[model samples]
Target: MAFSVLTINPGSTSTKLARFEGEGCVWQDVLRHTAEELAPFGTVSEQLDFRLGLVRSALAAHDGGAVRLDAVVGRGGIIDPLPGGTYRVDPVLVDRLRLGRPWDHPSNLGGVLAFSLADPLGIPAFIVDPVCVDEMAPEAKVTGLPELPKPSLLHALNVKAMVRRAAHDLGKTWNELNCVVVHLGGGVSVVAHRGGRAVDVNSANEWGPFSLDRAGGLPVGEFVRLCFSGRYSEGDIRRKLTSGGGLRAYIGTNDMLEVNRRIQAGDDEAAFYCRAMIWQIAKEVGAQAVSVGGPIDAVILTGGIAHDAGFVRLLLERVQWIAPCLVYPGEDELLALAQGALRVLRGEEPAQDYASSVLRQ
Candidate 1:
């Protein structure tokens, strides 16, 4: 029996839609939004109607109106920390997404958009392995300062998907292997997966190797002094740390291809910064190796940046000794979302309820 699932992933300037029949995607499209178009919306929640309209139009245009959908799944947003799985989008979850608790991001619109589409059809709506999935051990949460405990935020959708893929390739169940999964994208997350649970990770937004955009972990003393210097505002500092830093801060651009082009042109500075970033990634992989506390089954590299063969070759040279490196490039999040919902619809895995899974801070 085939289950038809519509997967929605709302990014900063694009809403990706995919219609899947069982494990295969029959149709997919990316709806691009310009700055002027999105400028009217004050908050992410406010764009619910706007995004929903676009999704509806896209579906209708693509003959999705004639296709019967069994389930609708969206990319999970930053909600309360919870275990990773396919989650049924309930009223409690909807309310939370509308409120945009924790923070207001474009991803918050995912669940709401999914529910709006699925509700009228009387089909189940779900979110898969959102950014807030927290499976960290108690010890891993502690830091030098008791108040500033580590947070579990990563590319959970892609990280977990790649981990499962690695297990599948190894001909082992996810619970049977310990894997270190690294998602190298605009931001990077190096996660230590032990027995299928992410026990430790460098939260992509706050810590880890500096990526194409993010600053990653920084020296606290200098950072604190800079914060107190009053040369920049809170938002400015945050933008610097999250987006304005990293390769963009060191070089002029964040595109790996452009960086490689510069390196090929004998631009020594570009090559130096690129290699330094890779070195940081290798170091973080080693740290996660200790976090798992035993022999690692594999070190998985994924996400958009992993598509660069030269970058992957350089990174593999550094971390391959820890474990056999598995490269599954590109974050195919729409497919991952569809697979999560299909697992529930097929009864292969029970769909988790959002109310019950909410982690109490």
Candidate 2:
């Protein structure tokens, strides 16, 4: 069998699978399920059974095609600061990921499923930029408690990788460019890149101003009081933080497309929330420019929201004078995953090691 790499992205209700051999795509498909279908899984691993089963069936039916991979990579969503490059999933990281049940990001399960599938098939299993590759600068990783610092989960891999490719295509380099990469999706994150590193960004909740389904950066004292006031249980607070915060917090909906439709119909509430979302995104972009200490080379907007001209227009208007704004809207995560795996396959980069023992006891 020819060596290949499979990239699986397990979303909240959708699992996207794609196979790439060398520079070309072999197979790509999305298996969608209802929320109820996933609710019974209990853990991310259990859900993997369902997701992989779906993929197996899909593979069986993919135009009579049969292909296995040399390396199986999934968009790992929980691992942190793993050298900002492709890596073989280590047992240490996997153990921590499986046991660390505090995080509830849907994409967190992507890595577990990749490992589970790869092990049975006797192929390398890995995750690309799980929880993003952007490790914030030590000074930028501050929490209210002087002693407690945390890393931010910005889409560092996708943003940086895509920008690097874009710059290269234009005969430029990332270190020579300062740009804003906007990630618009269910979970939105915009990163400011400078000198090939993500200096300052709104990757974590403590820093983000807001997002489509996130409350974003907020006043910690007020949030702590709200958490301590006995009005919300820990679970309730988590739900709000993970999936209920943003516009959904105010209007009970997270679909920006639907929100736009309602706005066209003259629903003042929808319009108001839409405007707020755009405004908040613009504000964050401004902050990113400032973080780079001004004179940003360009503002590059990409993501689901960047596809929406109206939203893009709003952002452009908000910061047109800042610098030239470029849009690469829509996600290239699958592309980045494939490219990373290919780098290893072609000997451009090293493969991730998965057999190492866990570091934390």
Candidate 3:
């Protein structure tokens, strides 16, 4: 029997949801939250019930008319470092997300939202390849300074999904291939997947390439100086590093389409900055190839930014020598989530326990 599942992927201002029967998506749509609708919630966790209400209303409007869901899955968020797989949601996981300490991301609500629906219905809920899926080799975690070790936060769901897709296209299993998967979206994360394990990755939340909005990796001494400069508060510095930095910092806007338009319309400075971002991304890909050790099988680019032909062409020019460059534009996180639950339902993979030995501090 095919299992019906609800997949939830929450973003800052929008929730991407889909209803799937096994691997087939029956219904899908994005639920956008207006600023006024989200203003009351001071914290992302606080918006839980409000977001859940919206998800339910969307499902209710489905043409199937109150579809019976056997399971629910969501995009994972900041929790303790764990292996990449499907995890069964329990109070331990829900409590961790509610506390919101490990890291606060909109995706954190994914697990919360899944549980809210699955609990009373007496069905299983799962989170797949969460952002905190840490498979880093010990050397990758060393940051030279003992106090600041690198964190393995990446778009694991999409990256892994695309990697497997690419492997299938190449007539090989994902475990038999080695590739560098780059996820370029609002935040960018490049990961080295060796033998189906993500041995190392740059966290988009902390640092990597300066993406459309994120500052990425910053000069430490100058960053520290700026933090102590007293011209900004903690929130201001955090906002600057996260939401207000990168291309937005250089050109006063984060929309790459607008930047590309200006460049086409004879804006030299805009062209320069956009090219610079692509250069930085290429440099990051090269760095990860080193981490994975030489002779990358293929360099795959997947995510929203990969859709830009000009950007991809420039990036390929820089990194194509290292390996074949393939583009799998856009993310399939909603399907990735549902498939995680489907694997367990089909007994293809076992659902891991949240409080098991797999967790590492």
Per-candidate clashes come to: 0, 6, 0
The residue-level lDDT of candidate 1 at 15 comes to: 97
**Candidate 3 lDDT, tens digit per residue, 142-181?**
9999998888888899988988888988888887779999
Q: What TM-scores do the predictions have?
A: 0.98, 0.86, 0.94
lDDT of 2 by residue, 1-361 (tens): 3457778887778989887776578778889899788878777756756777887787678735456568777787764454366767656666756663556666766777778777877877777765646545666667567777556677765677767766775578756887776777777677777777777778545456567778877787899999999999998997888778988888778887887888788899977777887788888888888777757777778777778888888778987787777778778787678777777777877876544321121
Worst 10 residues of 1 by lDDT: 63-72
- Whole-model lDDT, candidate 1? 0.92
| Residue lDDT tens for model 1, 1-361 | 6898999999899999999888888889999999999999988898888899999999999973788889999889998999999999988899998888789988888988999999999999999999999999999999889889999998999998888888999999987789899999999999999998999999778887998988999999999999999899999999999989899999979988999999999999999999999999999999999999999999999999888999999999999999999999999999999989988988889999999988886
lDDT of each: 0.92, 0.73, 0.88
Instruction: Specify the highest-lDDT model's number.
Output: 1
Cα deviation at 190, candidate 2, in Å, is: 1.9
Candidates ranked, most accurate by lDDT first: 1, 3, 2
TM-score, prediction 1: 0.98
Off by over 4 Å in 2: 1-3, 35-39, 63-68, 104-106, 119-122, 352-361
Q: Give the best candidate by TM-score.
A: 1
RMSD over all Cα atoms, model 3? 1.7
User: 257, model 3: CA deviation in Å?
Assistant: 0.6
